[model samples]
Target: MEKSPTTHVEYDSSNAHSNGGDAITRVPTQGKDAVVGTVRLLLGNETVLLPTPSPDPKDPLNLPAWRKWSILILISVFGCSCVILASGLGPIFSVIRADYPGQELKANDLMVYPTLFMGIGNVLAMPITAVIGRRPIILLSMVTLVVSSIWCQHSGSLGSHIAGRNVMALAAGQSEALLPMMIQEIFFLHERGRKLAWFVFLENFLVGIFFFTSNYMVSAWGWRGWYAFFAAFNGLILLFSIFLLLETLFIRPDDASTGQVHLTLNDVGKVDEEGANELVFRVTTKDKDFLEPEKYGVRTWRTDLRLWRKIDNWAQVSYFYLDFLKGIVHPIFFWLLLLNGAYLGLYIYQASTFATILMSPPFSFKFNSLGYVQGAQILCCLVFLPLLGYAGDHLIRFLSKRNGGVYKPEYRLPSLALPAIAGVIGAFMYGQTAAHPEKYHWLGVALNYNIIFFAFLGANQVALTYAVDSFPLKAGPLLVVVCAGRGFISFGIGYAVLPSIQAIGYDGSMNVVGTICAVLAVAAIPMYYFGPTFRKLGQNYYGFGASKEHANGGSGH
Candidate 1:
């Protein structure tokens, strides 16, 4: 490896940039064709690493494989715990309504309201996380989750219990935005799909498993015991996070590009004759050398345990909310907002009503055995886990190879096809079967319900992953748009679904839902074909693909 002469550089930790959009905008581009920036392939035209890693061992991107997976598992478990806490009320809904007597509280208010706040909570979390760090936000939310669970358990009034659940939903909302953002921070582009699938799989799988088991818990110890179970689970997660969860935000020195660093095929050939791949990409700046892990110092376990990280540019905090609004309007973001919301709303509506429909029909399902319906979803997830996990990354890699090693975010869009198709078919089957329980066996409802969940799992992984891939640095704000949009939209759907079912009947309501899914499905055709052009048009409008000069005084990259 070659060495560059070292020179002292003044550090300015103060905020200089008005918005941190340049973090992604500063990546060098080839042209309009390169809105996502082009990757200079290896000698064999292999896919180049995106958001290139620094030499610092302390960089999350450079962490060992075991360490990265460990953190991912911990975060996934935390997210799963939140899911369990948020949805436990559903299985025990009958018991709660019986206790409340003649109160105006209904199933939607109990379930939909908290679900809505989860979106509200997601929006609230981003600004704070943007300012402080992800670790602190996780710990803070976990504390809220624990307290709210206890409050929900011991509530003296119907209103108070509902309020407690809303608070718990708010706390649980952090998992929606932060978990995906953290996964993006830790994993490379090639690995994101699979890792994200791992997180979603755990969440969806646990939701299914919890529904299956929650009734038994309620039967043995009452609905309050459900709350107690999650409170303890959350408490344990809080402990694990305090010691094992490290901060993933890695800030480069002021001289380096805030955008991802990459080396071309030519640049690789310029390295020393030893052919050391580790030292090949280190030719960064005039004064400072890249790959200097020693300068950053060794990160001891104590350092990893730190909750708050220094933000070199606090001015970036001011832009977090504004970027969220901007992201809401960005073409791709808006599309995903709708796509995610429609699927999530459909799923929530089904889960909320699945029990009521089954237990009250001519088919007459036993309350104790209602969980058997969710077993189909669990099996679907188990089958789809490996498929959804690896398929997106694999498909894009193949597409990238065929594109002469230039990867486009559009490659990720194609995978949305599965969910879109599933939505249309599943809604039709579920709606028709649910409406006529006498003609169709209850198994029809269960099997189609499984199909809807399959769509939910696929849509979630693809939509979230594509958005992050499109706007890598701006993931936090973009996810706020995605998570909050889905939450609010789904909340509205949850609030209205039962009324719609009552007014129009299950078949008619599902026909409307199936039509909406069809429209979204059709929209994907254009999105896959013209997504890059749309992205190019919106890049400047959204503060993406801009030059480094746009970074102004630098937002610490």
Candidate 2:
């Protein structure tokens, strides 16, 4: 009996020769077309034409730029609001403690548990979002957030507060993963980096804004007033989302028979019947039943009002779960997961330790003054985010043009350098200042905090963009690993940070964490050099190629 042919085209490095090496070799597979896309060399870098947008005007990719931005901005706001509720609690832990006198409500119990659950919830939420639709899950998550906020505001005991916070965290996790996946769905390859930066900016900046204001809100009406404000704010966002957000999920087709075709750079050499270069190739249908919607129509009041409508693709639950697990184990995904986890853990440690340092002897900041420090970090983000976003997108464009219009995911890795250097400098300054608070002015500490925030934002935007560029088809599942891994790891580190700081003074703790962050940031160096090889390996081993749905004009959702 003969062995079955592999689905992927293998590129064996050992078999290269002087004459244009066999970078891609196709093997015949039964029931599928033999015309696999070609991977060409452009300026010594591997390149291929990405999947073209479907002709259907209703396809998310084919939507007008203005319309896409509108939707993205709304989603960003909703997501940012959810994140603010989660992180803003850190600044108000004292108020909460005072509210429930004699109750054992540690930050770990109230804040860390919710943080951990936010990640844990994604394991359940993402697979559902993958099956159901993005719009439904988002709206539902917002409703849950609203209710949880209300419950938290009325909590009379430690257990009730923990439960409410856990629910709220679960709701927030939906946005954390879904926003990036939505960006991948709506934006083109060249556009994702900057858009991701916008998403990160909104989340981090809003967290600062909310934290800054919570001080006043608590002072004016007490801690419950803070939860009430969140409840009202979340409720408004939920209403706005229902009316404004439309379902971005579409079923794209794979074959040319239904007016869709997949293409490769190799086809640039072939001619069509009209004598033009046949740059696009046609593939057979992998799933003929999947069809693109006719129009990219905006959701009406009636459509949006149907809160309980069943999503059509819910039967793919098993596949969604399996895909998420498989992505977690893939080398590229694993590397990104670890990198994200380390960076987030370090940031969380900084936030947790910041409160301890400022609330202590040298600079006994009043309740109102507690949030002013974050203002500097927010300002820092405001200045650097746009520049970094522009630089990241421009870097890829410049490198692609330099390499003869061929773009590789590794091009994004250089942006990592800014964050790596900034993190080291910021950590040293922050640690030294914190070690001798009386010697170094508080403003210097604030400047170091801003530096760290700037680096964190830059690193996050680059990593997310790189992940999507590397595996556009598998983005949904890949994000599950990124979001969940970061959430859990950060929670663990956050829980321990206070204790660690107590054990070893500020300088010792900062040195340990800063060293870890610097090391992880530097790993991007090796990734930039070897990333393409890993992508090729994933293609062969995990079918990292564009899915039939994505290639054939079906939704990659």
Candidate 3:
């Protein structure tokens, strides 16, 4: 018997006199109405080959419980590779500055250029992924990244390296869109807050470790080693993906509308009393007009890799723009962006410049010595990672129980306030320290560094979970937006950091950055107070209401 979904079977015991006593068996799918096997097992009459599955989700072998952990472990590995890839390039910024020759270019611009391209890459990926798919997008992106890494290693001019970095952004940067998207696919309604925490930690904090390690590598093996190292690790990641990572692309979003049932009548199974031999009856549905599975993906030589090239221009014109418009209108989406930019952007902004800042006078730090300052972010992240992981989950679980097993996206926001407050304070302190490099400075600088990154770890975790909760089904596209925002904010800050520091002398400019952050944070209050309500209200208003409908049931939850 072929195994597929929505199948049924029946049992008939009508014939008995011709032979000895005969037994019958019947099995029905969850929604189907029919009998399966004998009502009583002890009678030794009927047995089911593959028992009918219950509608209530009770199959131990195929149940989500058994498979979820397996997927989580895999998702964690994939997510961590993004972490390693994302952070590993950081420490090499200075070496890159030395090797490349763009005279007028600021030292921090080395970090910023790639980040700027990374944001652009994110914008490009959303449409490409929607048209292609996640797996193909990931595979192609990895190859792009791998080639770019090699290009970077051998480049002569600053322009060549920048080109390579742009290619890297085109490929490797998709992880920003991919990680949370994958999480939505595998986890259940309740597991998102906790499951995505592992992902957020890997994406945000672990990158710091990679940054530190890259610095160490540069110290031992020189600047070229940074690219060599990136390529080597990237190759390993590709191998891990090829051998172990399953294809998560081309799979349709889980939706009830795409599922259906068919009706059929068939004979029941019978068992002979003489030797206990059993006969079975089955019914099947034949498809009349089978859909031509759309060929999706960029074409490649590998036969299996060849793509069906139909452009999804309508989806492109509609998806992100609608998402963008709705995002602007629905306070939740915008709020998520602000919190994301504020918290995640804070650490990214600070860390990218830390090396340049410390390497200069006052700190009087050397090449590799500047990396020691990264300890602040790594250590601070270690402290808060576990806290952020459980807090969102606990609050959601608590609210779900109170609401009679129902969960709301808004429930995830309470503990988030803690990090939000802590982050602003951290940024404020760091700005004050920079404002007066000559005065109340050393501890102020250290504390400023510590607090911003400290709050960053937690804020990032909560904010991402909230986004997933609010727009579970569209987690992919929404994440693309988040990635864009992060790339822009990070690149913008990193690009201008040295110049700003040089021109304004820390405090004056930091005060500016700090002020921008404070306003965004304050403006986000409505998102906190009225987020869930607004998500619902915008469903009918915007033509793209699928995201809103999912939040209640279909969305990532």
Candidate 4:
């Protein structure tokens, strides 16, 4: 007979029946009683408890709350600064154009190539990080960012400027992939959504601030001033990272003795003993801290700041390569890549086109005034940050309770609804305003931009949380996919936006893009309904949850 979803079988070698190890036994348990005698495999909710942490003091999960948040805050600053450098160039394109008037490269192309390189650079940088550790790679990337910024400041031609930006993109790739992994390393599943929200908020807030500020910097001191400012800013972050950031790549072995249990056929009132049989029982227990207490005399500050820490020579480069390939081919990951790419493309399209639209004909917004307009996005993000971050975390807890404590990744999907609606309205209004700026007031455009940004930020947080929760073991490779896919898509859209506007007129282009956004946003429906089945399929075919040994009685690893 086929086993039910709630049924699992465990073979007990120590208490096997004496039939020369050939015969088998059967056990049956029902309802709440089914989980009582088995090794507490699942939590009170039917969700599998994944990769139970070791009882080691130095385990990342064992760290104090304040310590974890401190590291997260520092990393967030580093990530936010990288995003500013990547995007700050967009608003100052006019200044760049004025300087290199006769060159073949347009200001938009400068934006396009660097964005593309950021994605490509992630592919190259992530595997090395997996081997060398997150801290060293991040420090190296910061140093590269500072060096590249200096190059951009000194560049006299379009070629040299683009070259400098591309080099920066190569270094900035670390933040895109590393930040999410850092969150996964430190926080529990329940805390991930809220933490991810904070990370996403920092990124959006910085993007808005820099884009707004770039206009003023360009108008006041010229574009070189922008590069100088970023170089100094990144240098400070590098110093902080060197002194404060600890290496989070500690390996904790699964402890089967404390972590697992065995049950017999007679334990649950059902027994069929032909000779030797497998009895599988599940026990549920309250969550407890598995980390050991920190040692009193150890000096962690010296250890954290060590520049030449030993690399993991045992890390197989080929294994990471295969993992990356697997992430690329994974069905759910592929879907996430498309969704992330499209959302980023839409946001970049709006931002890249914003200054051009308002600086012309009807509005003729002064360079200094661009900050106020972009401030609309910042305002919306700030408003929704709590709603999306804190509320979304609680929503998952509530939904999990409703489902009898069996948390499926699909719980993350419902939060996407409000964002989808916002996107549709924002796209339509922005498109209409752009098509007829004289007909609709500029406030209409600003309001629509606010709505779109709010939705986009929310969607990003939800989607990323879902991705990490669904495949925590593969977080590194999965983020690589997300970074690369989103980068290429954003580049394509940024490159095409000007020509598209000229060809279709602003209204037609916006309508087309809006429709696509709506479709993509609604795509979550099928995922919500079918996600459990898809996860099961992945488990069967590719061993998706194999790394989560705690969930399966600490045997797989």
Q: Say which candidate scores most in TM-score.
A: 1
lDDT of 1 by residue, 150-222 (tens): 9988988888888898999999998888888888878767778888888887766777787788778888888
Each candidate's lDDT (Cα)?
Answer: 0.70, 0.66, 0.53, 0.66
Q: Compute the lDDT of residue 279 as modeled in candidate 1.
A: 23
lDDT of 3 by residue, 30-133 (tens): 22221111011111222121112112121111234535454445545445454454444455566766655565364444455666676677677655655554
Please report, as a residue range, the 10-residue window in candidate 4 with the lowest summed lDDT.
16-25
Alpha-carbon runs more than 4 Å astray in model 1: 1-33, 37-46, 104-107, 252-291, 311-314, 546-557
List model 2 lDDT by residue over 1-557, tens digit each. Answer: 12123212111112211111122222122122221222121322322223434434455665667778877878878877777777656677777776666663363577677668888878887767655667788888888988998998898778888889888988888766777878767765656778787777766677677778878888898888888888888888877777677667655433211122322233356454445532233122121212224332443457545554355455455655666677788877777777777777766767666765777778787768878887566686686667777778888878777766556788888988877788778888888888899988775566777677777677667767777667666666667778787788878878887687779877887788788888877788888888877887766777655553332111363
Per-residue lDDT of 22 in model 2: 28
List TM-score per model, in order.
0.87, 0.82, 0.72, 0.83
Clashing pairs for model 2 are: 58-296, 251-554, 251-555, 252-553, 252-554, 252-555, 253-552, 253-553, 253-554, 254-552
User: lDDT value for candidate 2?
Assistant: 0.66
Question: Which ranges in model 2 have alpha carbons more than 4 Å from their true place?
Answer: 1-51, 101-105, 253-315, 546-557
lDDT of 2 at 453: 73
Give stretches of model 4 more than 4 Å off. Answer: 1-51, 253-299, 308-310, 313-315, 547-557
- lDDT, candidate 4, 271-296, per-residue tens: 43423343423222243432223422
